[model samples]
Target: MSDDRPLDPVQLDAYFALIEVSSLLRHTVEQQLKESGGLSYVQFQLLATLGDAPSGRRRMTDLADGVVYSRSGLTYQVGLLEQAGLVTRAPSQEDERSVVVTITDAGRAVLATVFPGHIAVLRELLLDPLSDDDVEALASVLDRVRAHMRSIPPRSAAPRRRAPTR
Candidate 1:
């Protein structure tokens, strides 16, 4: 069913601006993560999420939900982190079918090393352009949007990863 309500010109402008800015921000962060720690942006996101968790661990599905990645893609990134000795994965005690991933001390060290630069980049690229009021409004608006998005059933965050290039 389609709604017959008219679209506002202001909403169209905001929608396009949001899309363009988000794309640019993601690209910039991907480049920064690659240069800083030889990490893909999604890898850094996984590490950061695990690092910030109270238990320093999360189930595979939970990690998949928390980050912009698919379950299989998250599994792949977890494997990379495991191979790098930055994290560990084991069968969950509560649910044998679910895997639990935990950030290691090495993961924390990597975050400590990289977080400062991450903040600097965020400030320079996003925050510096906004006034205090603008920042507050942006945060409030985005938080509302995020809540709306989360209320919907989730789909794959993006296309599944392709085979690596030689």
Candidate 2:
């Protein structure tokens, strides 16, 4: 059952702080990615994920899960990347029903171009201010929270419902 009570003051402060920090960090990262590589944050994430994969490729559903994005949204972003010649999609060899997305050499180049700025922004805005202990504590907290959240079924893992016929 859900708790009917409100968050304590400290919890309220932490929640607001997390939200604001997340927004600020994303905004800065988005600007850097767009300026450096002509990519949106999600596009950069897609490329980076594919680039990091052992085979430089991933199934579309896996991509959606890895990036915490909706499948439809991932498809549109992949389409844009395909049009830009940064990525390609093909039917998975292992599963004909699944589409696989792969990063092109050009996509790797874009990642290389943007990664430095991305790291710099992350360092300046997120990490530089934190002491080593603070960083470690934050990491531990986030890891536990992430694991807890992931215990729930992700959107990609859920079966899609069919529309009703008229």
Candidate 3:
């Protein structure tokens, strides 16, 4: 049988603090991205990731997994980017069912324009407060947590089953 108990105070505090900090960070970054380049944070992330790819392209599913956005949400954002001429999407050369997204010259230009301000805001809001050791530990801890979370199905998708009998 599993333990169905509630979290202890320490766990509760940590959980709340993590939630609050994530909310604040996301809000601030979104505002910064919007003001700087008129792009949502997710859009900027998608563009940046594509820009860094060797061919300025990646499979749609790869992009979806690289960011926090859902696959459907990424499709919508990619549509907006395509309309703006910032990116192009086509059937993957290797797999017809997969899509490949490529950052265009315009996309690279936007990233170039936004990079400075983005770095400044990130340093100010997220990095400046952390010492070197703190930053390393923070990355390590969050990376582990993210991997663990990704291993589980989201709550909405989790299977529902009847309780077991002895």
Candidate 4:
């Protein structure tokens, strides 16, 4: 009998490569955003997310998730924006425990000014080197990977059972 245990080699390689590339790409984009827009990447991300939200506002937790930041980090960033008069936070009508973050007119104006430059720099860093066909192929592959990931069941954080009484 052959003793070959089951393992997903392709998934393992893809997962590792994704982790490495995500970190590197994020850092590179962060540097570009800082230099070109004079805005930290987190601030730019928050403004963009807020602009995309319905009513130009989102629960603070939603904004935090969009930017991959902790709740306190989002609070601090929003506090800075509030000080700059670029954004406002108010109580959420839908949920008392949640705060709604909305971008102010000044924030929208700044985002508009920075948008074009951001697109140009993104192309320069990531897409300029790839041909249309290559980009399409990469996009297709990524879509497949994302779909596969979505197919997997979410991890269950089931509570542990206490030892049975003797």
* Top candidate when judged by lDDT against the true structure: 2
Models sorted by TM-score, best on top: 2, 1, 3, 4
lDDT of 3 by residue, 52-95 (tens): 99999999988887786677788999999999999999998899
- Candidate 1 per-residue C-alpha lDDT over 1-166 given as tens digits, one digit per residue, 9 for 90 to 100: 5898977999889889889998998888888778878888888999999999999999998889888577778889899999999999999999999999999999999888778888888998899999999999999999998999887747675446789999
How well does candidate 1 match the true structure in TM-score terms? 0.88
Q: Residue 140, candidate 2: how far off, in angstroms?
A: 1.0
Tens-digit lDDT track of model 4 for 1-166: 5758765899789878878977877787777667765678899999999888778898887776557677777799899988888899999998999899899999888888788878876687668989999999989999998777556622322234689999
State the local distance difference test value for candidate 3.
0.89
Query: What ranges in model 1 sit over 4 Å off?
Result: 4-6, 156-166
| Clash list (residue pairs), candidate 4 | none
lDDT (Cα, 0-100) at 31 in candidate 1: 81
Q: Rate the local accuracy (lDDT) of all candidates.
A: 0.89, 0.95, 0.89, 0.80
Residue 137 miss distance in model 3 (angstroms):
0.8
Judged by lDDT against the true structure, how good is candidate 2? Answer: 0.95
All candidates: TM-score? 0.88, 0.94, 0.87, 0.70
Worst 10 residues of 1 by lDDT: 151-160
Q: Is candidate 2 or candidate 3 better by lDDT?
A: 2
lDDT of 4: 0.80
